[model samples]
Target: MRKISPRLIYFFGALGGLLFGYDTGVISGAILYVKRTLDLTALEEGMVVSSVLLGAMIGAMSIGPLSDKFGRKKMVMFAALIFLIGSLGSAFSPEFITLVLSRIVLGIAVGGASALVPTYLAEVAPAKMRGSLTSLNQLMVMSGILMAYIINYAFSGMAHTVSWRWMLGFAAIPSAILFIGGVFLPESPRYLGRIKKFDEALAVLNMLREPAEAQAELQEMKDADEVELGGFKELFSKFVRPALVIGVGLAIFQQFMGINTVLYYAPTIFKAIGMGDSASLMGTVGLGTVNVIITAWAVRVMETRGRKEWLLIGGVGMAVSLVALAILTNFAATGIMSYVTIVAMAFYLIFFCATWGPIMWTMIGEVFPLAVRGVGVGFSSLVNWGANLLVSLMFPVLLQHFSMPIIFGVFAVMCALASFFVKRYVFETRGRSLEEIEATLRDRANVAEDDSVVAGTTPIAH
Candidate 1:
């Protein structure tokens, strides 16, 4: 095959992200229509909104091993097929249970894509451009969010009750495209090497790098696999524990900070702050717009600003924004803080877009060695989706009983802690190759013999 341009690889990667965004975000608008059509209560609405997350948790948990064993390309294609089935199933569901089931199925696809697409992109992209290329996943997600919002707006006012179904079924279009596109794309060179496909791996490497560099890259990949492949048990081993800590911590902190809570509940948050239903829905479009713009900015800065710095900036900004939000919401009954709450949310999102949003995904891909990369990312993502379900499931209850002030305050504290953790433990990975990172980790754990033991076998007491 002729060498695929880096640009082409990025294009397909973003296309995959587009499907992810559409599958994940389209439900936001459909929830209201489905609720009314199905005669759903508040609890049912929560269930409807969270069903996909349940599916996502399962999907995220499984995709890692499947990707590791089967290759990223095949797993992604399978995810696309799942997405297609889920979209069609959801669009034509005759009952609420069916719709929820479809959403869960869709979640599986979303979960898989969330784990695999960025990993594939990072492996294929040059280290210099890895941040930007991986970031395209976020951009595509935003784009999907934007597309869903527009489609929802267009369909929300339609006279027919079936309009919402159309809004949702539109996701299948992108899912189909992704599935077909994935069929034509090459598998990750790293995965090929793992399976001992030396010649094929060399071919992929040559396509991804200069011809002169392919042999050396293949050799490095082979050398890195000399150690035992990582498993669940390896997660607790001395060599892998730090990476696991970072991965799981990143996953939990990302959700605990309440970014998805805002995304999933933007309209409701706006309505609670005194905006009318129509106005709140329109305001959500603005949230999507800002999310897209800031994510674009993050893509530009990901490689430029070191990862640790961005996490600190994002953490502090998220905390400040959330605290401001809490204060605003606490007094929203007076109407004075309503607009302030909106602005605070906007700031919170901006900070997330700049830092935690894209960087978390990028860092997850970089932090683990290849042997355990799939499992680590999968486990972390399962935690992320699981946390997503917990928060989404409980946000309504918390809103009703605890008030927005307490809820957002909790998130702010989490954000503060997350920032501290990132600053203290996360390494700067800009421009570094994966092998170099692995070498650094290995060297950090290497044991040095004492001079007395090495020279004469004479022991000295301290």
Candidate 2:
């Protein structure tokens, strides 16, 4: 048998993210028609969109244990099956409630993919290449979003009812691809090591790395496995607390910063600003194009620039872009401002896709100790999706009650705060092995304990 290329492994592993992006993003276009067809009130429309998030929270919470018990590869395959079922169910829904339910099922798969893909990629990739290779998940996600935008545009010419169905049903194709491709992908060597399948883990590492490097990495994995698999107890313990804080903080900051408003409602925003349906959807395609381009660029440069720096730089750009958007909407809400909205959105995506967008996922996958990596990443994803749900459900409500300036201004403030969050908490993970990152967390935890003792206070244990 011909040896499989590592690139093929990365491609299949990341395909879940493509499904994640498509299922989440296709709604941005399909909601236009779904609202009209269902005569959805703003609250109902919000439900239709955010119900997926409800399922995502469930999936995120459950996936860690399931993936731990069964392995990452199996859970990924399971998610693909859910994607297929949900896509068909969504496309053929006969009523509003059914459509919402279908999307909830889809959200479960989305949530699982969101947590699993980054973790899987991070585990499979070598530390030297980990940042970029792990970032491939984000790239596939952007590609999926871009594909959804194009499909939405293509189907925009059809009758409203039919177009939205096609827009949603297109997801089945990629889900099928992911399912088929996952069959050939190797299991994560780290996971195999964790399970004490040393021979299997070494076999996989050998396939992916130079002989000397593979042996060394396998030894590192074996050493890391000295700690038993962690549960909630270990996760909340003092030793792991800082990594938890960083992962959860990144998750919250990434979502509350308002990139999704642009992604989920770009067409709606343009439509509100007086663009027609075709023009509005076209505007989103432009945003999606920018998203894919910048994210691909970010992947190439991720190692050299490092996570923390790009995050800070992107934060400034995002804040400025949101501020410009607030001003633009306040002073010139229509006509040429429609074009300006697209431009502002493009800048926001450039900053986000290149920095927080990929890095958030990448670091969450990196920050946790290997013993609890799956659960740590899953909990972070749960928070991320929860923030996503709140923002998604509340965005339309906010639009109803507030002016665009107020909404965007609020988002700008959050973006600035995100920069502060990064500076205060995030450490550089560039070019570091996962074990090395975990060791730093251990060192920080120990220092905190020492300081507490010196200060004459017993450290509170989690």
Candidate 3:
């Protein structure tokens, strides 16, 4: 195995994340312009905002098998092309339908990249550095958000009608970079192994690992490959049930905490709390800034603190922040309470950035075995985007009837429950090879079986 520079892996992985960030965040700014120019009603506004998520749900659901069959690199390139077309189409969209359609396409690209990129990074990365390298995805995403905010602010006064077009159009630049950058990236070694292209897999592994390690890694992959590959039915079969549960659970929990609601509508939320339009915009920028700073901190702590610990910390923090936010909202009649809400939001952002935001992706990428990784991550991502759609679609309605306090309170309880779920169900994969983790799970299961037999109890399969 030839050893590649860590810098190269980090660069490519971060670029994939940049695409995720740019595509997802760009819409938040563009929707305002789109709604205004089209004279959209509440329903129309919801459609415009939720359309991309609908596309993402479809993309996330379907892209896994495509990535598995076609190779991660090719699928990513295809996604970039989709994003390019979506960006251009959205920028020049003359009608509501066209804009919605364009965003759907962008969502597909975003969804595919979201599922594939972290899996690709985790597969190629050395075990010791995997957390840090994979966290680049989140960092790039936050960077993309920050960049979008900056771009929107810079173009804020440039003929309001066209400014949104420019915002949507700007994504093309990063899409092009991702397309070009992806060309040079090697195919995932696991994908190669799954296809029985052992020599090619070995060569790719050699690039990422020491020669001795590469040889052993190849053997381990081959042993694991004995399991069935592909097909939706395979995902539910006895052997793969545990993996399916973890993947899907992670996906749903990641979104049910209401992170996207905060990300997609931070400006509006701040405005509702008494800030002027300009101050609200600045507040949104502050949210993005905090997101980026804490995401970087997550990358650093990921390896040190481990995934499970960070998740616990983040979940606790998120719950606390949300509760505080709810309290502030309940007291909004007092003008000073707005500042309290801002502080609560900042804390929420910090918790999310440091824990759930990055760790969720990293855990999803790591938990699945290579044999079923594509379907596992794909389905998980599908659930993720699906949950995102639900949140985006209902946030306006929830805000209208329940008040911010009730809405955020619901999210806080959900987050706290997620933390408990993690402690009970999530296994630690830190500092271990994929094969090693798989072996441990198998061993643990076997031990339970033996103990069950001796005690005359039924052993849980998972």
Write down the TM-score for model 2.
0.97
Tens digit of per-residue lDDT, candidate 1, span 259-325: 8888877877777777875676687788889989999988887887888888899999999999988
Error of 2 at 362 (Å): 0.4
What lDDT does the true structure give each of the candidates?
0.81, 0.89, 0.82
Q: Which residue runs does candidate 3 get wrong by more than 4 Å?
A: 1-5, 223-228, 333-336, 444-462
* lDDT, model 2: 0.89
Candidate 3 clashing pairs, residues 3+ apart or interchain: 1-206, 1-211, 2-206
Model 3 per-residue lDDT tens digits across residues 315-398? 999999999888888874347677778888999989998888888888788777666677778888889989888898888777
Candidate 2 on 242-291: residue-level lDDT in tens? 88999899999899899876888888998888889998889889889889
lDDT of 3 at 391: 90
- Each model's number of backbone clashes? 0, 0, 3
Worst-scoring 10-residue span by lDDT in model 2: 332-341
Each candidate structure's TM-score, on Cα atoms with residue i matched to residue i, is 0.93, 0.97, 0.93
Clashing pairs in 1: none
